[model samples]
Target: MKEKILNEAERLFWKYGVRTITMDDIARRLAISKKTIYQYFTDKEDIVYQVVNYHIEHEMIECTRLIDQSMNPLEEMLMISDLMRRNADMVNPSLLMDVQRYYPKAWDAFLQHKEGRIITDIKANLQRGVDQGLYRTDIDLETMARLRVELIQLGFDDRAFPNNKDVMTTQDQLLHLFLRGILSEQGFTVYNTLKNKEYNLTAYENK
Candidate 1:
């Protein structure tokens, strides 16, 4: 029952803005009484908080697994980035839009927490890349890493509006560009090969 309510709430909260959704709406959508929902959650705010927390926890676990340091840093970054882009609908950016649009406090908290975590992750991976000779030296790895991380987040975020289509900078392209900037000659070739590799959905292994 709790899972059902949360699942429905996650959908509703994403489809509609958080402030625009109410307890009654969740109950109605689930075909359950408000009283039943209240048993699991005290109020709409409580549910919203739970939904956000749950999403964050699930994403963090997936992210950690995908960003393994034992693998090549660039490869790790690419695979994790693919996971983020391909799974955006399951991610919280859709719900986060509502938070950003309405709940300023929640938005601020979300940014402070999640963005900080990502920065730390990127910075660490970048430092590892330098140590492993996968990335170039002489550049400020911290700033460049932060920029790449922000670009990835913005790419997935529908909030950053741009007018260009083909030449338009997407998160993937942004990532490639960032990688190109930091790559050694050898790394650059490897990255190009990765980009040109055809994606295969039939067997699901080419990405």
Candidate 2:
């Protein structure tokens, strides 16, 4: 029951901003009583925190799985980028702003995930790519990795891309530009081919 509540809550939260979702709304969406939700979570804040934690943990697991299965560092990045793009498509642009403004603790958790594990993972990936000759050796791995990490968060800024039609394209172009900057000659060829390939986003549908 708890898992069901969280799943439904997460689905709604992703599609709608968190601040606007009340306990009654969640209960209505799940066709359950508010008491049932209260039995598992103390309040909306509790639900948000748990939901964010679950979301981050699931993403980390997926990241690890993709890295493990990838043939090379570049492939892992491409997969992750597609995953991010698909997810961004589903999320409400105001979701992050709402969380940051209304849910301090949940926001802190997200910050920790971004600054800690996400940065570490990106740096490691960059180093691996460099070693594999897929990335430019002349680049400063740490700095470039951090820059990439920072750029990813910009997708959440609705103001940055005020024209809704261009949001996804702009975000994708940011990633592609980064890839072009880092890829070696052979890596560029591989990237061009992979970019031209039809990426199946069905796996991330309604993420």
Query: On a 0 to 100 scale, what is the lDDT of residue 102 in model 1?
Result: 66
For residues 1-207, what per-residue lDDT tens digits would candidate 1 score against the true structure?
A: 997898788777765657678898988988889999989987776787777766667667776766653257877777776655555433344455567666665566667765678778888888877787778876696698679756755664664745424222476678777888888777776677675553221211111
By summed lDDT, which 10 consecutive residues of candidate 1 come out lowest? 198-207
TM-score of every model versus the real structure: 0.76, 0.92
Give one digit per residue, the lDDT tens place, for model 2 in 26-79: 999888999999999999999999999888988887778778877888888888
C-alpha local distance difference test of each model: 0.68, 0.83
Error of 1 at 207 (Å): 20
Each model's number of backbone clashes?
Answer: 0, 0
Q: Which candidate comes out best when scored by lDDT? A: 2
RMSD score of candidate 1 (Å): 4.6
